[model samples]
Target: MRFRMILLIGTSLMLASFTMPGPTTSPTLDRDLEPVVVAGQQMPSFAGVPLDQLFVYAYSGGTWHQIPWQFDEVQDSTIVSSEDGLLDADDQLVFMVADTGDQASQEAWIADENSRQYPRYEVVVTDPLDPSKRGWVYVYHSATLASSVTQDYVNFDEVQALVTSDRYLLGLMTDHPSMDRLELNGSGVDILDRTKIRAEIQFLGTYTEEDLEASRPAATRDGRVRVVIGSGDLIAYRSMFQNILWIDLTSVPMRVLWGRFSTDLSPTASGSYYYDANTSSGVVVDGVSDSVATSPASDWAQVSGTTGTMVRVVDSTEAGGTPSTYYKDDGAVDPTDTGDQRSYGDAGVRLDDPNRQFTFRTWTYVLPPDQPNVGATYRSYARNPLQAQTNEQYHPDFATAPPTATSTPTETPTAPPSMTPTVTPSATPSATPTPTSAPTDTPTLTATPTHTPTATTTHTPTPTATPTTTASMTPTSTPTDTPTPTVRWRVYLPMLRARGSARNAQNGLVLSACLVLGSTPPRIVAEVGA
Candidate 1:
């Protein structure tokens, strides 16, 4: 592929000419981002709206671009920024959801100007006169944050423990989780020579399974440990527009398995192992059964060096983990498939929590191995995690949020005088972006090498359009309750069996500046963590 994109831009300019730190014993941090808001009472037209000009947007294909919004301001619990500027309430209008599936595997979250793919979106708004469907994500309130979008597709380098994304480069086993090698972004071939977690606690009196010969839980009992996410920061949450990679191993300490109590008068029934290491090959992560999953849970492992392929997603199993009999591809095994089925199993992220501690919220994906339907771009944003709601008014704006998309209207997007409309009072993020007729040198990252991924990939909503008198004013009032961001349950839940986390009776979201002026204005690139 063009010499694998010129050896990944010459190994990313030799990884931006080095800077080191992360080996382990902690502190490599940077990417555990988590904080996506829009409050100011959801926008009473954003009342005064000026916390450094505020901006955030995601409504793919058709229009309404502009992504990368940060304005922190937590106060009391730390994160300050009230400088009187406006955008108050608990202040935080942060933003992230760029799990970079690039608009669900190339539907074009724009591909020029700077690069675009505003991923984490879900809007179905269909009342086009009542067929009755609901769920929307179109909040455009801005002072100016456009040029189109791109920045934070996760090139994160925490000292090269690396967290790259355009699809894979990852290598950090620092602070553990079965990753110490997994290259596959440009055929650089590393295809995982590591990754393990085959726990087994047993107990409850003579817990026999023919005496632990790889004791179930997808067997491989303690098959060389791993399934670790970081805390205090090993990357707990990242955002490329919901670019999911959150593994809150509840702040460290995970036991692998340690059996011994045949009955030594039961010293409080102990059996500790908590991650020790055993396996050497690679791709261990076992656990399978739950009637063989559809999407509520799943676990299965198989990999034998093609030098690539790592999707790795496992979630919220405070205990009893297992699902998926097999997925097959890299090495497809089932010699007589003995990884048991289930016997109180667990592959990773299983907690009995008596200090046996375990917590692993999931979402790990890396595409770019020629990019041709890598299992539908990680199952439409890594097993569908959609459920974001807030209302005050979007005034018949763009619509469509199904399977991953919607209808079209085109037009409304103008503001390219450097995004015209700055309230002055800057708080950072103003480098380059006053370009206009774009095309500095063919960028838009070619979007992970031009789209093909399809297992559904919908989302074409561009509704209103053509407007522009500042997008014909539209902003209803009434919606109090402090910035509203309570649409929870994100251990990556396939949209909770098709929508069931609830949050759409209007909680908050107001920025009716309505302006999509000019074209390709979704790239302002300023992730100030604000």
Candidate 2:
């Protein structure tokens, strides 16, 4: 017993020593930054009253700390001020409202390692229905300020806390059912146009009366929204908090579900939630529910539900396409698993049902470590397999409404000439051709009219049409022309089941460690045509 104990302790030390450097070791500052706003410079007096009293937090030493890092050693003495309104300060994440004196716009004061202020750098925001009622303020940095623009609407209460990476100011907001992402240029001052930016939402729900009031939306660093529903379900909606179009999930059947998404999508001590397949309910996202892990200490419970059997992960149908599954440790997955469940950079769980016909309409961005500034990306899969029982094809639908002449720019112009860009302007996303045609009615399985009974299916285009291309020019300028961007589409398929065309198998999709359910033949196919 003594020998066994000693061996175990030695192994433990080895593991800890290998992992400690990632989270605890201090990263040397790449360079110094100056604050965005300073005093009496057409910027608000943010240092007054409530602003000065608000506590400041920084992510350093591998954790968020209340104590500020003293930068006296790196402070720069030379200060430069310009009439164009540049305020500089020491390194700090600052929040402030813009100054029109008595009628000011919302803005922030960011200080760098060297105490210099960058002032009057207006923060872009969404516009409101009422022109007089300025929407929520979206704080950005001087570098990317000019290129970013404001929409007509914003939900101030749903704003996510801002986090800074070395070069960007990320504005996180809950666009209700949608997820929102906004970028700030880190190099110089520029204005952001409201028309060029968009927020994406993933889930659909109607806030209960109580939730609508108490359950305000919160933005995540990764561009997703986390909200507490009145039902205590603790739901997350991905998108911007401005110009939110809430989905009424009350009538939708066989809702596509998932286990709780942990911060960084890894297991956490705070615990998580899952969709219960047995009861068609929701349960805690725990280790015990997982199907294949032998280690009790590190296991997460499988999401319970009768519908759980239908939820399976699949493979990507094309090259350079994202793996059917997302895994942790690295992007490489074990090629051995027929289901293609292998280790990847991070892991994500998928939920589906075989009994009820389901469809994957859209996906929203989840939060990541360095977002807004750095940006976040995620993968989504096809509809539930349960829905496939009735309709042989449960793939993603990519068809969108026809592009209206006014919705999309006909010609690429150098900039937005003289016109003030509109807020939350609508764009027409072109439709991707479907196997049959986009489903116009509810999905149902019926015998074919031919004397020979066979599965007669109606195929729907996956929801992949949206403006996702990165804007080439910085958002800071009021351009003389509006450059029309080329649109693209993407979709996700699970790797847990087998069926349909084996061609999908060639894609050789992979999954994460925990998600690796011993290989199962491909049961479902997720198709996305751009």
Say which candidate scores most in lDDT: 1
Q: Mind giving the per-residue lDDT tens digits that candidate 1 earns over 224-252?
A: 01111121012222322111121112211
> RMSD of each candidate?
26.7, 29.1
- Which portions of model 1 show Cα errors greater than 4 Å? 1-48, 55-67, 70-86, 89-277, 283-346, 349-360, 363-530
Tens-digit lDDT track of model 2 for 425-477: 01211122111112111222233332121121111112222112222221111
Task: Tell me the TM-score of each prediction against the true structure.
Answer: 0.22, 0.18
Candidate 1 all-Cα RMSD? 26.7
Error of 1 at 189 (Å): 18
- Each candidate's lDDT (Cα)? 0.27, 0.20
Q: Cα deviation in Å at residue 259, candidate 1?
A: 18
| Alpha-carbon deviation at 257 in model 2, angstroms | 17
Off by over 4 Å in 2: 1-333, 336-341, 344-530
Clashes of 2: 130
